[model samples]
Target: MFPLEHIAIRQAAYYHPEKVVHNDYYLDHFKSRGKDIARFLQVMGREQRYIAAEGENALTMGYQAARKVLSDAGLASEDLDMIVFSSQTPEYTYPTNALLLHHRLRGKSRTITLDSNANCAGMVAAVEQASRYMQSNPHVRYALVVGSDLSSVNCNPEDEITLPNFGDAAAAVILERRAERPGFIDSLYYTDSDDCENIMFPACGLSNIYNPEMTPEQIRISWKPFDGTCVVEPAAADIEEVMRRNGLTLDDIAAFCLSQFSLKNIELICEKLGADMDKFIYVGDEFGYTGTSSPFIALQRGIEQGSIKRGDYIFFWSVGAGWQLPTVLFQY
Candidate 1:
């Protein structure tokens, strides 16, 4: 067997639509129905969210994030050896969104491009895969991984469960090979699909998506409340197992960049793990639940807030629909 090189995240940047939708935007609607959303909003740690307005979709938002990352990293699009795009609400189906991004960036012919849809766990999975690819292929040096979604537009406006929490956004990360150790470490994945139908997009299914008889109401994101506590115990256990396998304690980890879906969930995970709340970086209050981009968005904010620094060990994880869990340990 050959020795593997280190691959780590280098630069990060995120993007959201210009239209800012505050909590008050939905307050009147819920009020009209004799329901107060103030407590709900506070419980979910949602103060405001960015909604994708006209002319904004997953592709453009993702492109904006990717371009910013490339520029900040002092690298050009042609310098990239691979491009992985993750989005559930992608604007294209056959022509993978990654290919579209490559074309927009005018990438070279040898660049690798593909799309992945793992629900909210998309980016975390994408980063891990891209790192492994770079480590395996010596010619592949720089890779751009992006995760973006149109959460707001997909959520049914009347459903408070989805409408109030989701925000539309995109985040891009730069991964480069380094001659060092502990750059890309181990990952643990767990799936419990008993409640697979709790949340779904295009409820009518793809086969009926283009049927002329199908109405618009049958082809949008739907949300139904499930066991929210199902995330805490397992999430904490997974992170602990990953750290345990790597001989790391809570004190050894510099920061824990968890999903931005719910502050309560992050709190619960921290409490279960006996981890300090300060070590857990959260931006869900400001960014809302950005689906695929939530974890990376939290990571970028951690970098900006000085909560995480270079050469530090950071643990990343996310919870996707169908209760998918993916945890990754990396040196940033």
Candidate 2:
């Protein structure tokens, strides 16, 4: 089989601000000076996080970044064959962020647009979706895969647990068919919905609709550290499995980009697998927890900084709501 040569990335770009509630200005108002959140964020390997300014939402961010990718590739909106969007934060859960972005892209192209609710693991799954769709219809020369999240918007202001850590951001990657070496090598996806409730925004659903009287205070938001433990171990295990099947190991990986929710989790995962934790990048400190956008942003930043290069093996591991863990291995 010929290698996939044309499967190049079109300069992934993102939009986010560098200030949020965790900063010194915001923290100074708190009785403890937001030290708890600041220290937690520091240990998580996040220095600062970005927040969506007034009027900015998931759709806007996604639309803007996707446009960047399109412009960078010198491809018109009409050239896009499909729009695959992945995000936990959407303009609305019903219309979905993907459809919203499709309209924002001017609806000029008859692209088959679909949205995935994969949270942090959504990017890997979206890549899988694009790969299968492109393989089936080589006519679809280009696909825009977007990861735009507004986690900060959902954080209950009164709920200190989630309020301090959530942030907002968006990223886009343009993928095309390549008739050469492998571009997207392999992937593994798994979920444990039983533990889904462990880490979740337990409010804002149909159930809450029936009970409007349930105020924000009544809404339970569990942001405890252990909330992520269950999925972390499985995520690491899945990464190992993917590596084993591909005849590769951690050493072969040029970089490892995950959800970037916490620096501690990144360290633990690398330690468990005996991987080089130094290769891991952290944007959560500056971008906050951008949900699905984490991995995409990481990949883009890695390439720009010369950390990720052509022909380098890169692995992705992401875990978030729904207790889901998905992994992917690729060479760029």
Candidate 3:
């Protein structure tokens, strides 16, 4: 592990499509298709979401956002020492998204390419990893952090279960070392592998085990209606423990950037902590359930939209597939 002295988040960017899907359509279909679908969505507090129009994969979306980060940081592709792409949804199972991004970057071979599949806790985890990498490799000057997800493809549109809420988006952040002061303060990570079954894609990747008699189409149908309860209690308790470990109270946190799973869960976490709800950043209203892009998207949007101020102590909390809980503390 590298010891991080100082690191700053240079800039962040994201790509969200403008296409809109109406809630009424889902409501009507769910009434006849699966009532639990409608109820689940309603409680999730997602009215609509953005989806890639066409020919938009995670790699492309990530490229679009990563280019913005490069431009914003005023650094050329040659400056990056490492590219850490965080996403469970890769363009292909063979070549990782990091390699695809490297291609888009026009052959930056000097950079060590890697990918993280931590879903919700990805950004925080990436930040931690990048910081450690920079700390160890003193010669490495910069690292590119990408959190992208195109969840709409897995969304069961006709099933009316999780269609309206699933959206696709990508966010990229540049990490660089600083002399006087840096951005990230302290990060806390926790994982409960036992609760991995609480949330998942149901059918995709290795989970889609081949049945001896079932056809691919039948397997696909079995994977549809990917609906599961996004339990936050265990995650909430973990976050609280992290905060306590840092010897900081909820009031010490200027802003809360949480994994945007649902509106109800957001409220539940805030209420349990008795924290100010207004301090929490909300991206679900526009971006929807972006599996891994939630934190970075919120950070970029929160800063751009004036939701966060300079020198604000931002608290990031994320929970994902492994039921992993990772909390991060930063100042910007």
- The number of the candidate with the highest lDDT is 1
Residue-level lDDT of model 2, residues 1-332, one tens digit each, is 33344454545777775445555633543435433455654656655578888888888888889988888878877777788888766777777677777777765556888888776778767877687667667566678899888777676665544666667888898887777654778788887787565556545554774586877644545554455555668878888899899898777888988888777888888888887777887677777778888887888888888999888888877886767677878887
CA deviation > 4 Å runs, candidate 3: 1-4, 32-38, 158-161, 198-231
Model 2, TM vs. native: 0.89
Clashes per candidate (backbone, < 3 Å): 0, 12, 0
Q: Write the per-residue lDDT of candidate 3 for residues 64-116, one digit (tens) a residue.
A: 99999899889999988889898877777667788889888974678888888
Please identify which of the two predictions, 2 or 3, would achieve the higher lDDT against the true structure.
Answer: 3
Which regions of candidate 2 are displaced past 4 Å? 1-10, 18-22, 25-35, 107-109, 202-204, 218-227
Give each model a TM-score. Answer: 0.96, 0.89, 0.88
Tens digit per residue, CA lDDT, model 1, 255-313:
98888888888889999999899999888888888989988888899999988888889
Ranking by lDDT: 1, 3, 2
| Lowest summed lDDT window (length 10), candidate 3 | 219-228
Best by TM-score: 1
